[model samples]
Target: MNEPLTRQPEPEYMDLDDEAVVYAEADFADVNAAFVERLIELTPAPGPLLALDLGTGPADIPRRAVAARPGWRIVAQDASFAMLSIARRADRAMGLVQSDAKRLPFAPASFDLVFSNSILHHITNVEPFWAEVKRVAKPGAAVFLRDLARPDSAERAHAIVETYSGREPDLLKEEFYRSLLSAYTPGEIRGQLERAGLAMLDVALVTDRHVDIWGTVP
Candidate 1:
């Protein structure tokens, strides 16, 4: 059976009393930290790189990258004021902006590196996300985005949750399950990328439950 799509973003997610702590305590920071390491290795840009991080929940990825690379100026943005509030409390180094990813407040080609973590699945229509990613990114800008991949069936989704979030609290396990259902498969992401004129990006299954879109903007 096809898994039903379910997405809970921003206010609704933040309204949950456990949401903040769940994200704060989750073990996924290591995964995002690895993405940052890989991005630095792949990006050809030198020091003082201007970067934009979309949907920066608590700014964990930005925090990791900033600590490791002092020269990176990161503008971490999220649509949810609640999430931004949490991000602000987590780190003061990043410039936190509350803005929609589809219609960013910046000018064209404003950044050298654009990245996101697990934000794509929250978007119902992903075309706008890719369009905006291309618009804000400079020519040859490195992109590293990763998100959960929807399973082929609800049973598979349940199994994935059991495998990855079983040890977590009930709230987080449920949240992970919902995110998995909302996510797009690798094939779907490839189609969205092609439609958005981002066909050059490399779309791959980076993990059992996640798909990654990584490459330089053309």
Candidate 2:
């Protein structure tokens, strides 16, 4: 019998200048904007939300979120110095931290909101990622995580990439395909969340190629 599809892990960090540039240049404007809007709508009520963004590569999502809600105080965290440097160069985005997602340099229960976009699949050891999320978020903190869903096979992954990134640069398209291969399935991520004591959050497929794990921390 053929084995079920499995996640193909990729590098956890994009520390090189050219890699960071290729990623930062990719057009994620529509999806990133949608992520911010959906996150805002998910919050029960909002006034100066103290938000934490994990794996905030290039700082695009945080910047868009802050622009939509000026009261939000966001701190973007990434392990890649090159990515953060590009983010700063783009607009001098402040409060950026270059740290691994597993080792967040923040106090416990410190944030009203915790969110990440397209970062989950990059994590090789996902337990610490969710554990840190649960640890740093305040009680009842709104949590929204969006990531690509691993396709059933390489062919599907390539098709998804081509459909979405047809006009994108070759480098970007290749990276997108690799990311899809590396992304975790919904069941796998849910199990990870449960093991990390985050079973209360909801996990569901949000799109053909994406999964959204959302809801509030208990």
Please give the range of 10 consecutive residues that has the lowest summed lDDT in model 2.
1-10
Q: Write the per-residue lDDT of candidate 2 for residues 1-218, one digit (tens) a residue.
A: 55656778888898888889999998899999889989989975757889999988899999988888888999999999999998888767457988999988999999999999988989988888888999999998999999999988887888898899999989889889889989989999889988988889999998889999998898
Off by over 4 Å in 1: 1-17, 44-46
Model 2 misplaced stretches (Cα beyond 4 Å): none
lDDT of 1 at 60: 88
Residue lDDT tens for model 1, 33-65: 777887788775557899999988888889888
Question: What's the TM-score of every candidate structure?
Answer: 0.90, 0.96
In order, what is each prediction's RMSD in angstroms?
2.7, 1.2
- Colliding pairs, model 1: none
